[model samples]
Target: MDSNGVDEQEMKLVQGAAGYVLEDVPHLSDYILDLPTYPNPLQSNPAYSVVRQYFVDEDDTVPQKIVVHKDSPRGTHFRRAGPRQKVYFKPADVRACIVTCGGLCPGLNTVIREIVCGLHYMYGVTEVLGVNCGFSGFYSKNTVTLTPKDVSDIHKRGGTMLGTSRGGHDTSKIVDNIQDREINQVYIIGGDGTQKGASAIYKEIRRRGLKVAVAGIPKTIDNDIPVIDKSFGFDTAVEEAQRAINAAHVEATSVENGIGLVKLMGRYSGFIAMYATLASRDVDCCLIPESPFYLEGKGGLYEFIAKRLRENGHMVIVVAEGAGQDLVAESIEQQDASGNKLLKDVGLWMSLKIKEHFAKQRKMDITLKYIGTFCPLPNFNSSYLRFLKYECDWVHVSDPTYMIRAIPANASDNVYSTLLAQSAVHGAMAGYTGFISGLVNGRHTYIPFNRITEKQNKVVITDRMWARMLSSTNQPSFMNPPNGATEGAN
Candidate 1:
């Protein structure tokens, strides 16, 4: 039986507006799920039931599905399976594989470690393989044998012990490798693109009449995977961003007419910049990809910065990398390895505009310093901003992108990643494939990959969280503000 409690042959795929084309995926039957009644050694203890959910059968009159969000028409249905339940595969015969993909996240190694440990400690599955690089590891013979002891110290380190890469989402070749290794279960650690690849691998496994299980551990530093309350490594990213913001704050306050500009990582969302700005409470301006702001109008960012400088003498600005891409002179159709659109250096562009506007004004005693590797801060001589030139005291710009991403998991992420990894392994052992382990509504549950990647998780400007962030930073709202404030509440 599957999550919907339907027979395997009766299952059919159903497409939704969100683009998930799967429904009623079959779970392993009792015959194939040949295992002992007690897979968990601690199942007999009453205290152990705290972490488990026994089979639930609700009243027939009640609705079985729940509306996910008010903005979406679709809802999520319930699924069965908990800690005490018997796992589908027998431990001794199971040969599992783990693969990490996409960019570096703080909790990659932690997830890998926990999964290896759980498979070994909980199920007695001794044989495990780590696929080096991304899906390409599945294409070639790049694999390493993994044991609990081998990954005992990996959680303390950053990056994956198995290594990772992008753009190797070849499903057929990956399936071929799985068969070659006789892998019965595959755990994938990655973001949306990588999970999409996992989905393809699962479908291919099914098409080949193989009972292999494929599970995903949600991994977007951006925290944009939909339906999950929060993705692992997001809290760590936000925490690390505060250090950069603090550096900018220190630089800005240290000089007489200094402006500190910090750029953060948010491709299509503003959660990182917003949360960092809120947590740091030192930013005069916060910009994100989801919101666009003018550089020089009456209610524009230029006047806002000038006002702040005249009042506070120094100001700090936090901008997400994807913010203000629309303002660039040319369209940026180029994408990165993970299918994300490459954004122009909005922080650099805005800094140049501020320098030009203040210099042209002449009466305003202001200097702008921009520092970052994306564009030359001091030497950026764009033809577009060549009409006016002015000298500013200094613009301190720094990108903590790589530095922040390569660090070990923070305290919060350590717990979250371990739970996600444990849930992923348990799901696979329970014959749940084509799913991503996530914390939905505070519960550790298996979310179908199709549902997980159905939509991009962008910050809702109308949400109270955005409102609180704006309130904390005292920044002008790019979107309409509450209580009937002006168009761009300043």
Candidate 2:
């Protein structure tokens, strides 16, 4: 106390008997303590680690600028919140299970192995079960309990060892089973369809007061899952595509007189084809489902190949399997072995077109090699199994014991899959459910839980602008047109 019954100084420091000092200050510019001296541990919480890592710079400063080119209008609807609510789940109390649904992808085993290992080893979770045949496996008696030892050798295997089914599980029944088994956490690994099922299961479980946490692991060769940057098998699929393209290149180069047409798999999107084209520079042209090519059009694939043969001596064309050649065949009124009008095979048709164009216009001799059997090994069954059943007269086994089992683990997908599995487990332990762990821009990240809202999922592309951008023909618009149209113009 001062003589005037008030502290004279703007800041007052009181010392205690144990050498502890309390500093009291109000609007004192000179004596104000900096934020560095008073750190908030919540700011560094690991749950928001992924978000912070992306938004914060190397110097721990938040970036001032963020550029979002696409979905700007939809993005504007989102309002930034002050801080994320902390939700925690007891690691021991959480009983988790993983189920792989749909067809097998390259990294399914990798993800399965990681989930099993991460739960048991890192989080001290031992009651992790592997549901076989996806949703069906949950209700059926075929549910397999997984241990760390069971998953130890499965990193490199191509398919899910726990098995998968398309869409057989009754959501209510599955919830009942989960409750009966006392499963508190369920990790569903598959595509959008599977996620929809997972969401249903989540709703059912929550409704029943089981307190089960349901999360999804995005697994699809299509790479169409929203919010996630890239799924696990996408890289493997691209790698396989590159290998096929490189092999095709070798064959084309060795023949010296032939053009190789290789077809890739992608139904609605050209992500795989585009990524493969970027990976395998040897691919001369890439045709995707997003891009439709016409035989009569100027700079069409046929004309492009013909020009390539006339100019570069040989060419390799990569076509998406879904890019129907029916348009071209319909234009020409061609029919096939079934007495039904047949669309030309993309590879064979393009090859024939190239040959016919060269032979008619110029007296150039050209050989065509249509390499269409380049199926990736792991996904080959899923890609062609139905065809094999009908075309090859293969009998369907009613109780196919071997087909019901999961794939052996592969070495390539094991590491990343395990890392992702652990990340998901960590997130779950920290009260993050209904979110998937994703690797984006070459870094491990969590797809925000809120981003998977019903509105986001229900959002559809009414306009074809984004779809057109994915097309091969439209992509060239980004580059300045050549002065003379590259000599292939009609």
Among all candidates shown, the one with the greatest TM-score: 1
Question: In model 1, what is the error at residue 446, expressed in angstroms?
Answer: 0.8
- Tens-digit lDDT track for model 2 on 218-322? 766756565544666666677667655665676677655567666665544556666777667676677665555555445555556656666667776777655
Off by over 4 Å in 1: 1-26, 30-75, 377-398, 480-490
C-alpha displacement of 67 in model 2, angstroms? 2.4
lDDT of each: 0.74, 0.54
Please, what are the lDDT tens digits per residue for candidate 1 over residues 1-490?
4443323422444445653333433455422344343355435445446754443222101112344555654533434323535666778878999999999999999999999998888767899999999889887889999998899989888888899998978888889889987999999999888888887787777667677888889898888888778889888899998888787788878877778888888888888888888889888888887776766456667767878888899998988888877665454377878777766667766776677667778967665555455443333447533432334334334466555678899999999999898878777787767778787666666666777776889998888998888888777875533343222211
Indicate the residue-level lDDT of 424 in model 1. 81
| Model 2 / residue 291 / CA error / Å | 1.9
* True lDDT of residue 100, candidate 1: 96
Clashing pairs in 1: 369-394, 369-395, 370-395, 371-397
Per-candidate TM equals 0.84, 0.65
